[model samples]
Target: MGVSKMTGKFLKVKCGKCKNEQVIFEKPADDVKCLVCGEVLAKSMGGKARLKAKVLEVVR
Candidate 1:
Protein backbone atom coordinates (compact mmCIF):
# COMPACT_ATOMS: atom_id res chain seq x y z
CA MET A 1 0.00 0.00 0.00
CA GLY A 2 1.17 3.48 -0.79
CA VAL A 3 0.36 6.67 1.02
CA SER A 4 -0.85 9.30 -1.34
CA LYS A 5 -0.41 12.93 -0.39
CA MET A 6 -3.38 15.12 -0.92
CA THR A 7 -2.44 17.97 -3.18
CA GLY A 8 -4.60 21.05 -3.23
CA LYS A 9 -4.13 24.72 -3.99
CA PHE A 10 -5.30 27.48 -1.68
CA LEU A 11 -4.83 31.21 -1.67
CA LYS A 12 -4.15 33.35 1.36
CA VAL A 13 -5.67 36.69 0.71
CA LYS A 14 -6.01 39.93 2.61
CA CYS A 15 -9.12 42.02 2.66
CA GLY A 16 -8.71 45.56 1.32
CA LYS A 17 -11.49 47.06 3.34
CA CYS A 18 -10.75 45.64 6.82
CA LYS A 19 -7.23 44.22 6.30
CA ASN A 20 -8.39 40.75 7.27
CA GLU A 21 -6.42 37.73 6.17
CA GLN A 22 -8.20 34.57 5.04
CA VAL A 23 -7.62 31.40 3.07
CA ILE A 24 -9.74 30.56 0.08
CA PHE A 25 -9.80 28.15 -2.81
CA GLU A 26 -8.09 29.24 -6.00
CA LYS A 27 -10.94 27.99 -8.14
CA PRO A 28 -13.88 28.69 -5.92
CA ALA A 29 -17.34 27.72 -7.10
CA ASP A 30 -18.82 30.74 -5.39
CA ASP A 31 -17.67 34.15 -4.30
CA VAL A 32 -15.12 34.23 -1.51
CA LYS A 33 -15.75 36.85 1.14
CA CYS A 34 -13.87 38.04 4.19
CA LEU A 35 -14.90 36.56 7.53
CA VAL A 36 -14.12 39.64 9.59
CA CYS A 37 -15.42 42.17 7.10
CA GLY A 38 -18.38 41.88 4.76
CA GLU A 39 -16.24 42.44 1.71
CA VAL A 40 -15.84 40.34 -1.39
CA LEU A 41 -12.34 38.95 -1.59
CA ALA A 42 -12.72 37.02 -4.80
CA LYS A 43 -15.47 36.71 -7.31
CA SER A 44 -16.34 33.53 -9.15
CA MET A 45 -15.67 33.67 -12.83
CA GLY A 46 -16.86 30.41 -14.40
CA GLY A 47 -14.10 28.15 -13.02
CA LYS A 48 -11.65 30.42 -11.23
CA ALA A 49 -12.01 33.31 -8.81
CA ARG A 50 -11.17 36.81 -9.90
CA LEU A 51 -9.19 38.16 -7.00
CA LYS A 52 -10.39 41.48 -5.65
CA ALA A 53 -7.79 41.80 -2.93
CA LYS A 54 -4.11 41.17 -2.32
CA VAL A 55 -2.81 37.60 -2.26
CA LEU A 56 -0.39 36.91 0.58
CA GLU A 57 0.55 33.30 -0.12
CA VAL A 58 -0.20 30.21 -2.12
CA VAL A 59 -0.67 27.14 0.03
CA ARG A 60 -0.08 23.77 -1.52
Candidate 2:
Protein backbone atom coordinates (compact mmCIF):
# COMPACT_ATOMS: atom_id res chain seq x y z
CA MET A 1 0.00 0.00 0.00
CA GLY A 2 0.96 3.61 -0.41
CA VAL A 3 0.85 6.47 2.05
CA SER A 4 -2.32 8.44 1.85
CA LYS A 5 -2.28 12.21 2.08
CA MET A 6 -4.03 13.90 4.97
CA THR A 7 -5.61 17.30 5.42
CA GLY A 8 -2.40 18.81 6.74
CA LYS A 9 1.26 17.84 6.88
CA PHE A 10 4.28 18.62 9.05
CA LEU A 11 7.07 20.80 7.73
CA LYS A 12 10.73 21.13 8.60
CA VAL A 13 11.85 24.73 8.57
CA LYS A 14 14.95 26.64 9.51
CA CYS A 15 14.73 30.03 11.14
CA GLY A 16 16.08 32.80 8.95
CA LYS A 17 17.48 34.85 11.82
CA CYS A 18 18.73 32.11 14.13
CA LYS A 19 19.06 29.19 11.67
CA ASN A 20 17.29 27.03 14.22
CA GLU A 21 15.52 24.01 12.81
CA GLN A 22 11.99 23.14 13.86
CA VAL A 23 9.02 21.06 12.79
CA ILE A 24 5.67 22.78 12.49
CA PHE A 25 2.25 22.06 11.14
CA GLU A 26 1.29 23.19 7.67
CA LYS A 27 -1.92 24.67 9.00
CA PRO A 28 -1.18 25.92 12.46
CA ALA A 29 -3.92 27.19 14.77
CA ASP A 30 -1.57 29.82 16.18
CA ASP A 31 1.65 31.46 15.09
CA VAL A 32 4.73 29.30 15.19
CA LYS A 33 7.95 30.62 16.65
CA CYS A 34 11.55 29.49 16.91
CA LEU A 35 12.47 27.57 20.03
CA VAL A 36 15.98 28.91 20.43
CA CYS A 37 15.20 32.47 19.45
CA GLY A 38 11.91 34.34 19.47
CA GLU A 39 11.36 34.60 15.74
CA VAL A 40 8.23 34.23 13.72
CA LEU A 41 8.76 31.02 11.84
CA ALA A 42 5.22 30.71 10.57
CA LYS A 43 2.32 33.08 10.79
CA SER A 44 -1.17 31.74 11.14
CA MET A 45 -3.30 33.18 8.39
CA GLY A 46 -6.57 31.52 9.53
CA GLY A 47 -6.37 28.73 6.96
CA LYS A 48 -2.79 27.90 6.01
CA ALA A 49 0.34 29.05 7.79
CA ARG A 50 2.41 31.70 6.06
CA LEU A 51 5.96 30.44 6.22
CA LYS A 52 8.59 32.98 7.26
CA ALA A 53 11.46 30.55 7.58
CA LYS A 54 13.11 28.50 4.86
CA VAL A 55 11.46 25.15 4.41
CA LEU A 56 14.01 22.37 4.66
CA GLU A 57 11.69 19.43 3.94
CA VAL A 58 8.13 18.20 4.08
CA VAL A 59 7.60 15.43 6.56
CA ARG A 60 5.61 12.47 5.38
Candidate 3:
Protein backbone atom coordinates (compact mmCIF):
# COMPACT_ATOMS: atom_id res chain seq x y z
CA MET A 1 0.00 0.00 0.00
CA GLY A 2 0.98 3.66 -0.47
CA VAL A 3 1.82 5.98 2.44
CA SER A 4 0.12 9.14 1.17
CA LYS A 5 -2.78 6.83 0.41
CA MET A 6 -2.56 5.67 4.01
CA THR A 7 -3.94 8.47 6.05
CA GLY A 8 -4.26 8.64 9.87
CA LYS A 9 -0.96 6.88 10.53
CA PHE A 10 2.44 7.99 11.76
CA LEU A 11 4.50 5.36 9.97
CA LYS A 12 6.96 4.46 12.73
CA VAL A 13 9.82 3.12 10.73
CA LYS A 14 12.86 1.63 12.49
CA CYS A 15 16.42 1.68 11.31
CA GLY A 16 17.89 -1.66 10.37
CA LYS A 17 21.40 -0.94 11.60
CA CYS A 18 21.06 1.41 14.55
CA LYS A 19 17.47 0.74 15.53
CA ASN A 20 16.61 4.39 15.17
CA GLU A 21 13.11 5.65 14.48
CA GLN A 22 12.06 7.43 11.31
CA VAL A 23 8.78 8.27 9.63
CA ILE A 24 8.20 7.26 6.05
CA PHE A 25 5.46 6.81 3.48
CA GLU A 26 4.25 3.46 2.22
CA LYS A 27 5.47 4.04 -1.32
CA PRO A 28 8.87 2.56 -0.42
CA ALA A 29 12.20 4.39 -0.56
CA ASP A 30 15.98 4.27 -0.81
CA ASP A 31 18.70 5.90 1.33
CA VAL A 32 16.35 6.11 4.33
CA LYS A 33 18.39 6.88 7.45
CA CYS A 34 18.21 7.69 11.11
CA LEU A 35 17.53 11.34 11.79
CA VAL A 36 19.47 11.28 15.03
CA CYS A 37 22.81 9.58 14.40
CA GLY A 38 22.84 9.62 10.61
CA GLU A 39 23.19 5.87 10.55
CA VAL A 40 22.68 4.01 7.32
CA LEU A 41 19.19 2.63 7.82
CA ALA A 42 17.16 0.15 5.81
CA LYS A 43 18.93 -2.69 3.98
CA SER A 44 22.46 -2.49 2.76
CA MET A 45 23.19 -2.52 -0.94
CA GLY A 46 26.88 -3.06 -1.74
CA GLY A 47 27.65 -1.12 1.47
CA LYS A 48 24.97 1.53 0.89
CA ALA A 49 21.73 1.49 2.85
CA ARG A 50 18.59 0.61 0.96
CA LEU A 51 15.11 1.43 2.19
CA LYS A 52 12.67 -1.15 3.46
CA ALA A 53 8.97 -0.83 4.32
CA LYS A 54 7.35 -1.46 7.67
CA VAL A 55 3.69 -1.39 8.73
CA LEU A 56 2.48 0.91 11.49
CA GLU A 57 -0.80 1.41 13.33
CA VAL A 58 -2.92 4.41 12.38
CA VAL A 59 -3.93 6.07 15.59
CA ARG A 60 -7.20 7.89 15.24
* lDDT of prediction 1: 0.85
> How do all the candidates rank in terms of lDDT, highest first?
2, 1, 3
lDDT of 1 by residue, 1-60 (tens): 133553346889999999999998878888989999879999999677899989999966
* Global local distance difference test of model 3: 0.52
Q: Which stretches of candidate 2 lie over 4 Å from their true place?
A: 1-6
Model 3 C-alpha RMSD to native:
6.9
Q: Could you tell me how far off, in angstroms, the CA of residue 33 lies in candidate 3 after the best superposition?
A: 3.2
TM-score of 2: 0.86
In candidate 1, how many Å is residue 4 off?
Answer: 7.9
TM-score for all models, in order of appearance:
0.82, 0.86, 0.37
lDDT of 2 by residue, 11-44 (tens): 9999999899999988999999999998999999
lDDT of 3 by residue, 1-60 (tens): 455654433356676656666775333335555687776445535343345634344332
Candidate with better lDDT, 1 vs 2: 2
Off by over 4 Å in 1: 1-8
